[model samples]
Target: MTPRWYEEGEEPDYRFTLANERTFLAWLRTALALLAGAVALAQLVPAFSVAGVRTGLAVLLAVTGTVLAAFSYRRWAQVQRAMRHGRPLPMTWLPFVVGVVAALAGVAVVVVVLLHTR
Candidate 1:
């Protein structure tokens, strides 16, 4: 069944709709990559000097990916709705949140590698 919001807004331009879909797909791809990274870290990477650090990082990635994947659809719908209503696109915190988390994860990985190499 179509979502009620889908019917509420006037039909947006085809190009805009397609673009929104593409954006959504891109988010999905990122989510998939994160999930893959999580699995790789969990299974392929050696244990860190600090016990549970690797597992914690892996869990963090998995959770981030899951949340991003789940929210991408909602974001897409929100954009679509805004376009249909001729309103300004809504601002989102997702990118900022993702960036901070990713950066932290990268830093954690670097720290782990450095500590492991010692």
Candidate 2:
């Protein structure tokens, strides 16, 4: 008997696999939007506060977006592997990470605006 390529596991349903791909694409789109937003904010937005504030905001958002994209890839792979192996999905920290970074960016923006006002 010949061992199949999926000999280590079984093939999951096509619907599930396709759904996963769609989700990955969605995350990629979100990453692209964030990156675009960063560029627009940095280059287009007038300086509401001190110089570099917009750039800092853009950098933070860009970093968050990059992290989300990386995590999304890792999570999708892990999920697919887990499904193939019939293993439980792994927990992830992406949401908390994004939230914390977003909060920090908001605080930075507030501070910058305040500084500009004074």
Candidate 3:
């Protein structure tokens, strides 16, 4: 009988397998980096009256970063599984990411301007 596609007698698609693994690893690394940045922001702000805004922004960033990190692996896994099953890839989160980054940037700009004008 002809061997199944995934059987030992059949040659597996090494390139596809390797590419999926690499993509997953890249996403994981990105998640870790984001979480680390958030931790740094949350830790480095000092305690002061006017520091509240900074603290808030830092906290927001930390939370967003955490969310991104948490979602990265799950999304990656979903995509990998979809690819294996020959299904459509999951929709990209680029729009949400862009919106969040833009909002964060706006907040950061306001904070910086306020600090500078003081």
- Tens digits of lDDT, candidate 1, 65-84: 99999999999989999998
Q: Count the backbone clashes (under 3 Å) in each candidate.
A: 0, 0, 0
Candidate 2 regions exceeding 4 Å error are 1-7, 111-118
Model 3 regions more than 4 Å off? 1-12, 45-50, 106-110
**What is the lDDT for 107 in model 1?**
95
- TM match of model 2 to true structure: 0.78
- For candidate 2, the per-residue lDDT at 71 reads 82
Cα error, residue 83 of model 3, in Å, equals: 1.5
Candidate 3 lDDT over residue span 26-107, tens digit each: 6667556656765765687454345466566666666666666677767766655666567677896844883676587577
Better of 1 and 2 by TM-score: 1
Instruction: Report how far residue 106 has shifted in candidate 2, in Å.
Output: 3.0
Give the Cα lDDT of each candidate. Answer: 0.92, 0.80, 0.63
> For model 3, what is the alpha-carbon lDDT of residue 60?
66
Candidate 2 on 1-118: residue-level lDDT in tens?
A: 5334335588888898788789778878887787888888888989875777788889988987888888898778777777788888778787688778778878988898788779
Model 1: how far residue 97 lies from native, Å = 1.5
> Model 1 residue 97 lDDT?
74
| TM-score pick, better of 2 and 3 | 2
